[model samples]
Every structure is written in structure tokens, then in C-alpha cells.
Target: MLKSALVFRNAFKILKTKYLPYTKELQKVGGALDDEDWDKIASFLPFRQIFYDSTLSFFGSRYVTGNTFVEEIYDIGYRINRSIDDLNDGVKSMARQMKMKFDKY
Candidate 1:
């Protein structure tokens, strides 16, 4: 419960810092959204949705199973999803590379 709360808090911070600024600035300009503007906003949605989904899954699994192992597995799945996401965003981190290598084995 407490862990999920922390995750939600951090997610909100990321949304505010990384996403809200752009939207707010656009609104302030009173301009219609061009395709490029829409594309920029759409690009962030998948990453944000992943965070929300992982948080929900973490808490949901805990309540349903009450098993630490299950929770850990869920966490691992989320980490892998996040790594793939980062790779899609052009971030070739060590973890993402390792995941890709392991997938080929």
C-alpha cells in the first residue's frame, strides 16, 4: 500500500515536470494543436500509461495473492516493459541491451 502510494506520487511528479509544462504552454499560446504538437503529446502517453498500469498491477496482485514472490514477479515484468519502452524511445541502456540479448537465447 505504502509502496504503491509512493509510486503514484512519483508518477505524478514526472507527469507534471515532463508533460504538463508542454501542454500548459500550448494552452497559454491559444493556438490549435498541429500534427507535430499532437504527436509530441501522444509520444508520452505510452510511457505514462505503463507507469499507471504497473502501479495498479502491483497493488492488485498484492491484494489478490498476498504473495511476495508474485509481487516480485510482477515488478520484474514491469521493469522489462519499461526497458522496452526506453529502447523504443532511443535509450539503449545496459538493462535494455541485456534483455534483448537474453530474449535471443
Candidate 2:
């Protein structure tokens, strides 16, 4: 019970520190976000690493005797998903900027 509670607490901390800033800033700026804004968004993660915070959060769950096939597959999928998410977010911001820039012409 305590472990679960601690996990939840840690998850919430990760959400606030690692996830919320980018989203909140995006919302706050509407579509006028700039490169500096994205840089600030990226800065939330340690060393700007993909899934660094999330992977650390699951440190206790890492394989002790080498990962099973299922674990290996899940890890692959998780990494792909994280990469896609990061790309998607950045692309969305860039798309907005492009649209706004072209609109002025």
C-alpha cells in the first residue's frame, strides 16, 4: 500500500515537473510560441533527454536477470511511443508557427 502510494506521489511529481510546464506554456501562449518557448519547454527534462524522467521513475521495475521477451517488447514500444510523442509535440508547435508565418504573407 505504501509503495503504491509512493509511486502515485512520485508520478504526480513527475507530471507537475516534467510534463505540465510545456503544456501550460503552450496553453498560455496560444499559438504564438517561439523557439525560445520550445527551448524552455524542452528544458524541463534533465539534459533534454527523451524519457529520462519516465525511465528513472520506473527504475525499480527494470529487469534484475535480463528482460523477458514481453518486457523487451514493452520497452521497445514505450520508447517508440515516447519518441513519437515528443516529435508530435514539437511538430505541432512548428506547424503552428509555420501557419502563422505564412498567414502574414
Off by over 4 Å in 1: 1-30, 61-105
lDDT of 2 by residue, 1-105 (tens): 333433355454455466766557666758333445545454333222433543554564665444444464455344444444344466445445544543454
Q: What lDDT score belongs to each candidate, Candidate 1 first? A: 0.54, 0.47
Cα shift from native, residue 67, model 2 (Å): 3.0
Residues 1-105, candidate 1, lDDT per residue (tens digit)? Answer: 434434465454455467866658767778435545444444445545544765677667546555754665556556655656552343335447656754565
If scored against the real structure, what TM-score would every candidate get? 0.33, 0.22
Error of 1 at 104 (Å): 29
Most TM-score-accurate candidate: 1
Candidate 2 segments whose C-alpha is farther than 4 A from its true place: 1-40, 43-63, 68-73, 85-105
Tell me which residue pairs clash in candidate 2.
Answer: none
Task: Give me the overall lDDT of model 2.
Answer: 0.47
